[model samples]
Target: MTMQRRQFLGTMAAAGAVLGAPAVFGQAKPRVVVIGGGAGGATCARYIARDSEGAIDVILVEPSEVYYTCFFSNLYLGGFRDFESLGHRYDKLASDHGITLARDMAAGVDRDAGTVTLAGGEMLFYDRLVIAPGIDFADGSVPGWDLSKAEIMPHAYKAGPQTQLLKAQVEAMPEGGTFCMIAPPNPYRCPPGPYERISMVAHLLTQANPSAKILLVDPKEKYSKQGLFEEGWQRHYSGMITRIGPDFGGDKVEVRPEAMEVVIDGEVERVDVCNVIPGQRAGAIAEAAGVTDDTGWVPVNPHSMASRADPKVFVLGDASAQGDMPKSGFAANSQAKVAAMVIRAELSGSKAFPAKYSNTCWSLIATDDGVKVGASYEATDEKIASVDSFISQTGEDAALRKATYEESLGWYAGITADIFG
Candidate 1:
């Protein structure tokens, strides 16, 4: 942790003094078990621990030693961010907030008994549980694509070694060769992610392989901020990118990884590189805990993000089926804060505030060129509905786009601190 982050933590502690320390319950501090230390789980654990001021016992269950955020990962591909910048350790979350970091996978959850079983056979009893396991791809969502063949056609959506693999493949493409991407269906993690990835790849190829062509085989007829993306592509990378939506042979797609071929609408096309983003569902833990509905996502109370099946278990981030909120990291972090407040009120004596949430997703179309869409949300009895929204307009001046990109850098710094600290 840097001295700046340490100073921020000190200021946070000082603020806690003004709010009064949380009331402890019984002989032991109430325990909160958070699974998957990504955007949602980490933020929830940190807020509960920091705001409660030692009144709640927080345990973070994550398999990895460090977390790599899916957010800003496209910037890495565009050479605007380094791989290390995307990784965050749990040291500040544990040391500053007094959270117990358990680097272990949660294997099972016995909601009826209020206990979670770990992969190492240890059982943890919890007064409250938070499930924020992000996303897991559905099996066979893309025909003939599976985990075993990821090395040949890297999804690179998870922001780790796979991301590195995909970048390497793009850099190694033959001169004037074709690069193909099969975009995912609707309601996947990061609605604008696939398009941003296309932008980054195009930026790279402009200098490295200027004659290279990009093929976007997409299932959706239209995508998030389609006009803005189309305008940016035309302005910055004209004649190099082609998009085929569902009406134009994008829906009927099959991959042949062994032979490096993609069959679109009964026509086989060979490519030098392939990127397949399959359909997604909530992480496996949600289903294992029996919180998911027929839609493969956990249904929650929009106001508190409490699991509909069990109020004691809350689902956040991409795992949830909350309405009108895109599954971006910003949305997940916003939902975490709301859920943490509710959990703290139930476990400790912290006051619960009315649930208000917000998110903004920024994408880089080229160097110093960024576009964004965002909204504020309010929770109703039925769902978390959008209160107001905005998006980048096409034909915006370069100066404004550059400012937006710079603002994204600041947001990235602030949010990482918010989650890790």
Candidate 2:
């Protein structure tokens, strides 16, 4: 499936030129300034540069030189992958793809002037802008938690130093200690991420501290892949995990980070380590651009991912409030391709194809035990509607589970190359 998708993307790129050469707009080439070089932005930049064949200039604004993927960071925590393996550099994008890399944060956006201001005080004027800044924690969503308290109760959602911190904290935990996780609400990045992290942590503790307990305080009534995760947890690490849902006062929770305690409905439970995944909103730059609505997400046209607020501005990935698509890297990559096609057609007069998107999220439960859920989607008048779907069944055999795990490995390599190169 991974190889086929890569080939399809390549075919789309080549088929774009069948319409003829681009129509030049002015003396200088039409420039696209892409903000936040993650799955969506990076893939969009690469596709536009590759497909447009120098008709358009692409500039990527991102603060990080090495991007660590959140998708497989849980595997790193489980010791399946090393930290360095999760990191990817944009050298190929700049050296080979002719993309200009601005290693600085995007300070603000002037939609009226079609300019993006960087933290370094450089202003980039663009014919089009793509915003894919991923996610930011919503302020005060967790009553007693904030960015400052992240060191104590690390979110580790962004997948960098905080991930290492959480791993270290988990490793240094006292024998039979409690590890508490305050899972986020719905619409968070990677719908099944927290549960995967729980499985990985359980994997670690099962080896090092078999008596250690995992306490999950989740506000959501149900979560992504609940049946699969519960079944795997029972099979692999029995008697080690406990989950508290809203019915059990999980929704009414607060944390005392300094004291390493969780307060659930006025009852305090002392914990050795805490992982607080808070409610999230679009990245700050999107809100600063005045594109985000009251829900703190940028709504976009289903056909092209162009911001509804401003057609020239496109929003992708976690920042976008497109319907039915979970905020996953694969979904972002799929959306990026559609947006890149539309942008190329609009700016460079390439052949535009109908927008089609697909996403599959693969998660590992234990060593060689993997499961997946995914769907194919298409642009409709109202939203990106799912057309077909598939999921791994609960009672799958060991061989099938291992094959799923191997398939995920292939996907990671294929996708990272597709995005960065």
Candidate 3:
């Protein structure tokens, strides 16, 4: 699936007397098309516009009028943030930064014709393409899950309607009922995300319905910051939260939407509210474009972010299976800047300096505090690997808890600036 027709052409292009072998040979301000302006595409568009010296025509394709990043949406769910705070306008990305914004989804890619077809039936020709369209649920990965009834038990992974749907269910949860969270296995986006979400929601339920319980149905035996997370949960929530791991209860979901029961071990555990975050795969667009890996993530050159299938394309963020680097808004924003620099060098007929990268992800453990993970990295033969890292060491005092709380907002602000502000 990975070997492409361009390998021979690329080899000849490298061997021949071409002034520029890697980038567009003679195009001025290479017209680049970017899909999904959420975390990766928006940041990439902004950087290309900000630093490309007007030698790149940046066009962003997105369907949403405003984007609410999934990373910070937990804050909104915790009642710490107004819904308005999470909304980001694309006008700044389009108007201030000179990026051409398209409000439509990419429907098809005619690579040989250098065109990307839009959901509206418009054909956009590009000198180069960057796809950061994020992930999609593997259709019916579990027996009871399907598009027809995703409305009943929302994933909240998309962070808009899913957010609202899940919120309504949480509010409607009976005073002493159960709320369950089904966490997908490893290689999923935002490794530490769902646990942090359950933590925040559990905190909310502590007040709204003190007798409420949270059941975490996890596929994996362990999770990101497994030790730290459990420590925090036990200290704060204790009996309020219970997790079922692979060995004891197993992770498979035999979903029965009509009855609202997720079967495990031949038993039906009906819940007042269910949040099933199923196994994920690259957005179908990546697969359709023929850039996906065996695991359904895009394969790109670690250094250039160039697709192994089409060198003219660069894939970033959650859509690309960049190991070690968690699929996160911060990571996407960081990679966006790097991809911009590499594309800039290609446009200028120069090579980008050895790529060095950084990422920090902050998740709200509760309204009072947040836990963080951060790392600096460089590309390796296989993928972008980390050089330095930090994880939350137990929060010691009230002042430190306050500090962690404020730090999440600061990180969100700084990352928003990096991407769209």
Candidate 4:
């Protein structure tokens, strides 16, 4: 179900062939307005701004000045790395790539008028629009769970303030304190992200307070890298890790912040730290723009990523419903590249050839050891199917594990360079 990193590059090489010879078309550069400067939006902005030379005016709207990657953020929360390491600057995207970075959220979109409104009431028009605002939690799904409760329990999955709050709670916990984690339903961002987090926290507690344990409430029977994660836990903190599954009692996952307790089925919660990775919907911007269907996700063409409802607007990353692909940072970054290339060709009056996309997500199970999964995608009438994938072995090999750790840094550096420079 997953593709490995090495196989992804090979698939891309083959993809260019099936796409036929690249066609050349002549046209003036068109202005691009990109909303959300996360992995997907930022990468698209940089490529359009740079490849179009001085012809294209790229404006990027993002509320935050700096982006903290969600890929290895668990390491920071576990105390294995500093927060600064995950933070990235946008100077290259602005000064070097000539992208006009707007430091505000896109309040509304007037599709009929072809204009977008900023939170400050500023209006901007674009020849083309790219929406990649990441994800928003389904706050209505669970009863009595809202932003206020999120402030207390801290989902840290978003990789910003939540990450800091979780770290602080862990640091202040008593030696024998229990840490509770509530996993969301299937089809969410970073499928293996939560398990990797548990692995890192177990590693940290082994040093800081070995008596502490993690109480996991999983909505599904099995999850991404389930076998590998269980093997690592057995070798590391087998007894300290107690997992509750749907059959065993995972259905009881719910929380009350005022009581500072989470109920499992009908049981009272008792934990010093808590994290609930809630179910997710599309980003609020997508809903406001009326691009989402009942599921709150935009529908798009599998090849060009053009919205089915709106041709001038393209949806990428977690915001779009890309069949069979996980909602992941790497996937978003990869999708951005493909979407940008298609837009480039479209603006030049050239036809969009069938393009292939691939993504690999690396999760650090410990300081020197990491696990990864990846997949390659191709367009079809039914849906996108996996071309290839790879996964790390259960028990780590001395050489391979070390290479994965190095590869993680290489990935971060490469993606950052591709997006910013």
Candidate 5:
């Protein structure tokens, strides 16, 4: 066996031996099984391991060997970044932090038994569990569209092969052909994501197919960074974009992927390329764990990010329904640190402090033109309440916008290192 595989197997065996033993017996260190290796799970595993000082055995179960971030994925579509640049591996998480990497999907969670069954059929017992599987599209959210139709109409929301497929389709569009985007509703992953994608697509079209048009079908009447994006669109690519909101039947729409058509209020429109971002819910594992509510997201205690249903299980990132936090990578990363601290304190007798969270979402409107919105939050009895907020103002000078864009680049580097290493 490879050295890494042997190490992982050894860790699993050790954990299995202590499945019925109490930590008070001091036979084995407490074990934490984190499902998902995105910003939330990776950060949580690293912090729990590093802070516990080997007092906790951290096992991260993730199917993907290399994680591609959804935050800057729009830049990849715009040709601002290469696909490889968005991918991050887990080697450092394993080697530097002594985290056990189980490259397997979590198929089931037995809350009563405190065990997680992997797709490969290995059952892992955990003293504590963290689920941060991120977002999954809701079935039947869009008529005539499903996962099977994804090949024809790419969503590109998860930031991997779908992203590459969407970008390729955009680049291959016929000159002056129309491109359509079906934006998702509220409470979806990355509130500003679809808009940022629209801006990126516009950037690409302006350069290669100047005559091409963009059709934005949005269900909501307003969106994140609306004024700023509208100003940028007008200034950068005037007369090249059109938007249909709820009043104009954007909310009542269906797609015929086979025919390359979008039906809005019974009006049929043909497009060369279609990007369909359907409504989304917590990743499936959350539901399997019985933590999610009717809203299809796990309600977390604002104080510790522990699931309201089961305190032993904590939910983070897009899978959690923490109040006032948008489902963005930055928010997920921030929530993960808080959860890690709390989990360590609970299991390892370490000091725990009040939980504070913050999030900022930055979007690139054009070359070196960026905008942002963010807020600071604190845990309250009812929810994670927002304390203060800020947003990039419209009509900013080129120098300021360029500086904002540069700041985002630095943030990407810092956050990725913070997450992976």
Candidate 6:
């Protein structure tokens, strides 16, 4: 079923290039400039260019040439997958879909002028814009931890090199050493991410340094799939993982990267490695474009994923403040489809469909032991609200858990193809 979908989509992209390339108007085609080439932006760019044929000029402004997904990085940490497997390139979007891949950082957005300025001083004029730049760390949100000292305590939130560093640090921990993780607060990207990281780190430590301790200092009172995670932790890594919630001094935390120490509620604990994920907001380009609200995220129309601040722009993924949808890679890719459909309908006179979205987040607790949480969502008058939801149950049979893990592997293969192709 997944391969069929991929082949059909691939054919559509190929057909669009051949059948849709004639100039709609003499020389000037409607331009679409997409910023940030992650799940949302890459999918949006591919769909707009592929579906529109040659009616719209699609420009993807991304700083990095290769995008490493954060979704499966925890699996890499757990030794389920290699680091190289998480990386993806945009060569197909350019070669197959005829997208203009602008390998440069977007410096600013001139909404009134309909132009985006790159850091290299090139200006791209667009009739419509899509902003899917993902999240940025808030200034001074985590005391004593900032970008300058990232080497000492890597966040590993963005994937790529930081992920390698965090994995290396865990592998280098002394026997029975302590590994501390400072989890982020509410409304951040991937609610289940930190817990999954803890699980993966614990998986690694169990084999390499069985006596090592894992500490989770989290600001949130409760987390996504808490029951499932707690069960898995007890079943696979008993007495190895400890989570401190806000009521237990998780909120009041500070780090000293130089000394490799964490101060929690005025109590100091020295640790061998620290992974601190600070509070986050919409990416810098969204703020520069005046699309984000006061809460640091972009408010968008639920039906079209169009920015509420400006109808000419759309925001996707973690940067959007749409209600009820947890920010996951699946959600981002789902939202991108809705945005792409809307843009195609607006520009190319294509038929528009009602917006429906879904997401599933898979977390690996141990080798071949996986759990998942997922939901289906619909665009309501107010926001995108949950229609139905499901989660893996505690005490499920090992065979079922393994099957769920296998399902996620297929999904990862399908989604990466859907986004990149």
The best candidate in terms of lDDT: 5
For candidate 2, write residues 1-421 as lDDT tens digits: 1112234235425643321122245556888989998999999999999999888888788878899999999999998999999999999998887887777789999998788887756567788899999999999989899999999999999999999999999999999999999999887999999999999999999999999999999999999999999999999999999999999999999999999999998899999999999999999999999999999998999999999999999999999999989999999999999999999999878799889999999999999999999999999989999999999999999999999999999999999999998
What are the root-mean-square deviations of the candidates from the true structure over C-alphas? 6.1, 7.0, 7.1, 9.4, 1.8, 6.1
Per-residue error at 26 for model 5, in Å? 1.5
Expressed as tens digits, the lDDT of each residue in 26-78 for candidate 6 is: 55677788999999999999999998986788878887878999999999998
Best TM-score among the predictions, by candidate number: 5
Encode model 3's per-residue lDDT on 1-421: one tens digit a residue: 0112244235324643321222254634467789888788888888887777667777787878788888878777767777788888787876677786676789998778777777766566676788988989886666787667779878888888788788778878998999988888767889888888888788778879889999898879888877768878888788999888888675666778778887886778988888888889888888888889788888888887788888888888888876678888888887887888888787656557887778887767765666677899999988899999987777466567667778878888888877876
**For residues 31-83, could you state the per-residue lDDT of candidate 1 as single tens digits?**
89899899999999999999999888787888787799999998888777899
List the lowest-lDDT window of 10 residues for candidate 3. 1-10
Would you give me the overall lDDT of model 1? 0.90
* Model 6 misplacement above 4 A: 1-26
Global lDDT scores for all candidate models: 0.90, 0.91, 0.78, 0.79, 0.92, 0.90
Least well predicted 10-residue stretch by lDDT in candidate 4: 16-25
Global local distance difference test of model 5: 0.92
Model 5 lDDT tens row, 94-162:
888888788778999999988888886677888899999999999888899999999999999999999
Name the lDDT value of residue 184 in candidate 2: 97
Please say which candidate is ahead in lDDT: 2 or 5. 5
lDDT of candidate model 3 versus the reference? 0.78
Position 1, candidate 4: lDDT: 12
Relative to the true structure, candidate 4 reaches a TM of: 0.91
